[model samples]
Target: MTLETEFERVSMPLENPFTISRGTQTDAENVIVRVTDEGGMTGVGGAAPSPHYGETAETVEAVLPDLLTAVEEIGDPHALHAIEAELSTVVTDNPAARCAVSIAVHDLAAKRLGVPLHRLWGLDPSAAPATSFTVGLDETERVREKAADAVEAGYSILKLKLGTDRDRELVEAVREAAPDARLRVDANEAWTAREAVRKSEWLAELDVEFVEQPVPAEDPEGLRFAYERSALPIAADESCVTLSDIPAIADRCDIANLKLMKTGGLLEARRMIAAARAHGLEVMCGCMIESNASIAAAAQLAPLLDYADLDGSLLLADDPYDGIPMLDGEIQLGAQAQAGTGARPKSVE
Candidate 1:
């Protein structure tokens, strides 16, 4: 029987300013996709705007209507693969929107099969430990304040967003703010290869665990060069999007940051994780600013990943759905299993 598909937008305001190399954000607007089967089981998914990656509310909104129409025309929720194939043909760009629709389909499919999303992805949900919370770039005092808040809130690991001129100062302030916390840094491809290596020297002094996307996405050679020179482990973010991008980045990066939006959906993300593991790279599950829908989708992959950054929902001032509870800095997998990842808003109907 054919299923029904619908789309809408949810706006989540950030508790504080979220700044990166691309831009700053106070509110996170996400595209929410809902899929309902003939049996009445439903699954939800979210796609968050990554302005740095050229995604925005307007762009996602524009893309979602057509995507939903095409998917609904296909009707059969079980024909997810075929539906995704058809979707690729219609929506040529704005992968984040495609990802949202794809994830919703996967969630609905899992529900229909009477299995959790993680099991469908071939992962043991219990294996995913706590995720890391991010501290965006800010003044030292503000950085410390945020770090302190996260630490006090029960997060043991903190990912400090750096890459600008005051990288060292930010790290130091975070360190002071959360003395015993496990700290790491992400450059988000802001540094040149040379600058990455140079900055690594200073970061090493702060005992930063790893540095993510220190150089631009296209500079695999530079990434390798920086990896060789730095004592800190390098993680590939933008450089490693699809499974195809894995082999090239494997030798250069010690870790890979996987996001649902980048991988398109759980099926592809599972494949990417297996490939990354085969290449002997650790996996880090990350996310853009989103509500429970997006976080829940990524949570399915959390058990298999070495690091977790599913703090997207936690940063929001208000979340429309009760998807997963991120307590302290760790994601409560047990809670996730009980609640399931794809919890939809009651208003989604």
Candidate 2:
């Protein structure tokens, strides 16, 4: 059956000003894609652009019209890889836009089979690991407050944004606020090799799980130097973008942080998980600050992950779609008998 496609740009407001190594954002700029088959089964997807990855809302939106046209030309929602190949030829470098199309196709395939995405992939929902809610860079008091609030809300794990010189104080405050919660930190490529090793030692003392992307993406040698002596496990975020980038940094990191927008789609993401595992690196399925559309698509692959950082939707003040349901920090997907990614578009009322 021929597939019909459409897209819309959405700006999802953040609950708080989200700060990372790159800067801050008060809203998540996203693009939503909807696909409907001749049989009337519908599938949806979303993309959250990050300037760090060289994609913005304008870039994503600029590529969507041609992307939609390409999807219509392809005509078959089940041919995900084929659609992906066609999309690559249609547009280059817009991974977020590519991700939106890839996700919509996967969603349509699962919907056509009358099963949730995890079920279609032969995955177990119960085995899906708990996700970590993020606490962005904020004032020490606000950071402590946010940590306490997350713990009080029943979340067992918290991922904190770190990079500034106040990193030590911020982590210490949160540790004091939520003594029992498992903690992880993302440096967003803010540290130098020496600084990464030094910070990792300090972070390890506080029981931080792992340090993500300490050195900038441009410096592979720096990551290697830090990896040699880092007291905490180092996960590659900025340094690892696509499949090809994996082999280059495989020895430089202990973990691979896979995001749909980074890899361009669910199919490539699945490949990334397998590739990471093949190389003896643990897999972390992560996301940008996004709506439920992208989070839901990523959730379908959670069972394959060693760690999950899929808390993008949790940061949104209001989401345009409902997909994965996260309680505390755990993902609930056992009852998604509906087709697609099980995320339904919400009325903009």
Candidate 3:
């Protein structure tokens, strides 16, 4: 039976401009993939490309036609291992594309088994932790307003983007607005090791939960130095990409935030979570600015994580899919993910 595959490029406007140390995005360009088996069971997934990770929507689109053709030729959505290996050989370094294909296959497999992905993985959605909503880098007043708004909107955990010259001011502003909100920070590899140490100490004073990727990924020595000197726990984002990169930086950070786009798929992501924990690092499941398709895919792995920052869809002004519903930052799986990753087209009746 020949598998049928469909791909499309989508642009979703962000509710607000999201700024990080590396850059800013006012919109998200995603590639949505759907795989329909001979049984007419369709599983959907998406690729949210990150320029920081060397993938753009254009890059993802460029490689997907041939890649999807190869996947269709394989004709076995359930054999994800072979599919992933074949995909890597055809499309190199396009994790977003790989992630899209991988997730579509996983979704199909789960739907075929007539079980939710979490249950298929032998996990419980009820055990999943609440996800954190993010406050992007902005002026102090805007940061305060966003923080307060997020907190008031029922978000108990807030992750703030830092690493600017006014990092302290921004954190202070947010603290003033959402003092009781559990605050975490991501520097996006902008500061020097010494500077990271200083900022981490300052952030500790305000009760920050942890600092993510304070120093550059290229500088492992700097990461270790900052990790050793900082009073707060450190998490590695860019520094940790695929499974092989984990061991090299295992001891340098307290946590590893795994993004499906970075890992290339749910299989690799699950492996990454296990690998991070094996190295004694707490695991965080994260997402880029994506639709509910990929967020729903990542949410299926929520029961295995220590923290979750899967609110990328929440930041969007409009979403084209609905996989997992986030109610006030809480992951409301309910029965939505009962088939595949539980993400379905918003137009479905």
Candidate 4:
């Protein structure tokens, strides 16, 4: 059936500074897409650009108008393969923007089909677990306080933002604050090969479950080297963007951090996971700071993953739509049964 398209930019304030190698952000601006087929079924999607991945809100916003224009021209949500193929030509290389539209289309199609997104992708929705909450970059005391707050809020798993002058100290402090919580750290490609090795040693002492993107994305050799030396499992974030990037990362790292924006959409992300498993790499689905719409899309892929960082919705002060309900770190899929992308478009008129 033919579908209509609408687009907008939504800004959500972060609870604290989200810092990584690229810069710091106090607010998250996401590109939002809505698709409504002639059948009256609708779906919503959101795209958030990560500066660490070399994208900004400005770039994401700049690509949306053209993306909406292209999708409206195609006018068919069910013709996903055809529409996606056409999108590549018009949208080009902006995966974040493409992801927004892809998710919205998927939602619309799924809603029309009357099935949850996981079932559409051949997954059992009942098996999906809760996601992890991220502890943003901050001072040691403040980071510890945030960790405590997350724990108090019923978060079972906590991912800490690390990779600075005081990486070790921060981890130790966070661990001390939330001793029972499962802890993991992400450097966001800030460290050197040598520093990764050194930090991995200290990190091992904190009993961290894994360390993500400890070194720069380009240094596969460094990742391999660190993997060989560290007791902690290494998760490749920036290092593994596409399916082709998986084989090398699987050989070098233990886990893969799959972000929808990085792979473009669920289609590519599914392929990337298959490739990662063939090479014995564990999968962890993650997302940039986004609203419930984007987080809901990523949650559909959560059951297939060993780890989940779908905490983007938790970071927002307000989420306009109740797209996905997260309870005590666990994603409550039962809250929305008909998933076909799980996000419903906001009212444009």
Task: Give the top-scoring candidate (lDDT).
Answer: 3
- Tens digits of per-residue lDDT, candidate 4, 29-85, equal 887888887867777888888765667778877877787777778787777787677
Query: Which 10 consecutive positions of candidate 4 have the poorest summed lDDT?
Result: 340-349
**Of 2 and 4, the candidate ranking higher by TM-score:** 2
lDDT of each: 0.82, 0.90, 0.90, 0.81
Q: Give candidate 4's whole-model lDDT.
A: 0.81
* Lowest lDDT block of 10, candidate 2: 334-343
What candidate 1 gets wrong by more than 4 Å, as runs, is: 337-340, 346-349
List residue ranges in candidate 3 displaced over 4 A: none
Please, what are the lDDT tens digits per residue for candidate 3 over residues 228-289?
99999999999999999889888899999889999998888988988888899999988899
* Candidate 1 lDDT tens digits, 253-278: 89988888777666678889899999
Candidate 2 vs candidate 3, lDDT winner = 3
lDDT tens readout by residue for model 2, 139-203: 99999999999999989999999999899999999999999899999989899999999888879
RMSD of every candidate to native, in Å, equals: 2.2, 1.2, 1.3, 2.3
Clashing pairs in 2: none
Instruction: List the candidates' TM-scores in order.
Output: 0.93, 0.97, 0.97, 0.93
